[model samples]
Target chain A: SQQGEEDPQALSIQEGENATMNCSYKTSINNLQWYRQNSGRGLVHLILIRSNEREKHSGRLRVTLDTSKKSSSLLITASRAADTASYFCATPYVISYGKLTFGQGTILTVHP
Target chain B: EPEVTQTPSHQVTQMGQEVILRCVPISNHLYFYWYRQILGQKVEFLVSFYNNEISEKSEIFDDQFSVERPDGSNFTLKIRSTKLEDSAMYFCASRGRLRDSYEQYFGPGTRLTVT
Candidate 1:
């Protein structure tokens, strides 16, 4: 089952602008992770936020989790054209230790 | 930096035929996973392997699907009978060890086409 579902199926922004994507899951999660994928390429792990942690950051990426609301968001500040890709949120099932359920993903196109 | 690797970037098979997708995870990683994504669809988890046995599997991982660590470095996902609906991009992932901050590294993925 697909637990996480990203909003704004697609997004487009100019270079240097900020881009934000949101994801909502249907059940409890121990942690939520964000990943990026280039066209026809493998997924790249970006940042992960545990259920106890409200927020986390790495480089230009900022991820926030609202466990109470079962929602999370990924923000890319000062986005560059190179950041163009699909972003997905993944979470392991509450009862399944290592099985990761991924979101539908948001396609972001950073225009130069 | 060690990274996971997969073989036969693309595989084309006829329906009902058997197919195997191979992956070589990071040398020191202990957990291995298999996932698949249909074109323009979300990535779905199939199964996870640890201690040379399956730790957990998703509903999508039916009896037709099986995983094996044929050698020290090779992890493979075999489909007993391929179906046209089985066509998708299969990905292999691995993580170093169990920890609060562990992250899974993914391979380039093998594009499977079943006719």
Candidate 2:
């Protein structure tokens, strides 16, 4: 199974600033997903990019995947206080076949 | 919008006790899953169920854990004789059937505190 590891274990940025986090994984993957979890709560799926795709966008969020580096990056533009949450990158693998393996996560704190 | 719902948002039990976490996935979804997140750690997949059977499970899922679709809408995960290490938040998720594309919807987790 592929295990995604997010860089900058913790990040703090001012509201309206852009925040970027990187994730690297072990083994090959079918797709990579990004999710956000509020403190002590369930996770909300943000975006997903397949192995063949390079970049994807949803509103203010942009995700880029570099297969050769076996890594992916998530960039949140013009962040807000509501964006304060743990951002996790997950890679789907065949071991648990289609099950997602998540990263330790980047605890993002956006200050107003 | 449809959302997955879980029961008993929080549970407190003693070691060696039995616990059953219930989840009501989105009405039209076909795939269900269980995952756990220990404090200050990553989310871990426990099991995934489809067609009333476990399609896959993680090493963390041992004999003590079992899952069943007791009815059409409810999915349950039973942990027998829970250990202190069982303290974590358990999340239930569902996904519509898609061979090439899969987007899972997760329910608010149940925080289990094993005392």
Candidate 3:
């Protein structure tokens, strides 16, 4: 079984600063995704990076995957207070029916 | 921008009672799933449904748990007997049928508190 573990469990930054979160997994995966959950709310998809891809960008999010290390990182540039939430890294099973194994998550608080 | 919809933003039940959490996935999507997050804990996958049947399920999905797509557009998760540990936020998610499409859209989630 593969599981993702995120580092620096909690982070606090000022608005407009850069926030980076790291995730490491235990097994191989075809793709890794990042999701954001506001306090007590459902998760919102942030970005996905494939095994072959080193990096991917969507809006202000930058996700980097390093298969050799079985790790990935999510960088949010120009952060805002709205970005205050728990960010989780999830890896889909190799068989792919979209069953995701999620990380413990990084609790990021961007202060305005 | 179609999204998954779940009923009863919050549910309160007593222990040993049966509870059914409902979700209406995106109309065009073919895969549906249920996940739960305990307060202050990580989100955990419970089960995945596709083509009118469960494709995969986690060990947490035990004999007390059951899922059904009784209609073409609705997916439901039933707990035969709820326990205090079942208290958590239950989320419903769905994605398209493409082999390479892996992005899952999640609903607002239902907060279940078993007393």
Summarize candidate 3's per-residue lDDT along B1-115 as a digit string, tens digits: 7889999899999999999999999999999999999999889999999889899999999999999999798899999999999999999999997878999999999999999
Worst 10 residues of 3 chain B by lDDT: B94-103
- Top-DockQ structure, candidate number: 3
Model 2: per-residue Cα lDDT over A28-90, one tens digit each: 877899999999999999999988899999999999999999999999999999999999998
lDDT values for all models: 0.91, 0.92, 0.94
Which residue runs does candidate 1 get wrong by more than 4 Å? none
lDDT score, candidate 1, position A48: 84
Better of 1 and 3 by lDDT: 3
lDDT for model 3 = 0.94
lDDT of 3 at A64: 96
DockQ of each: 0.81, 0.78, 0.89
Off by over 4 Å in 3: none
Q: What is the lDDT of residue A34 in candidate 1?
A: 91
CAPRI accuracy category, model 1 = high
Candidate 3: pairs in clash: none
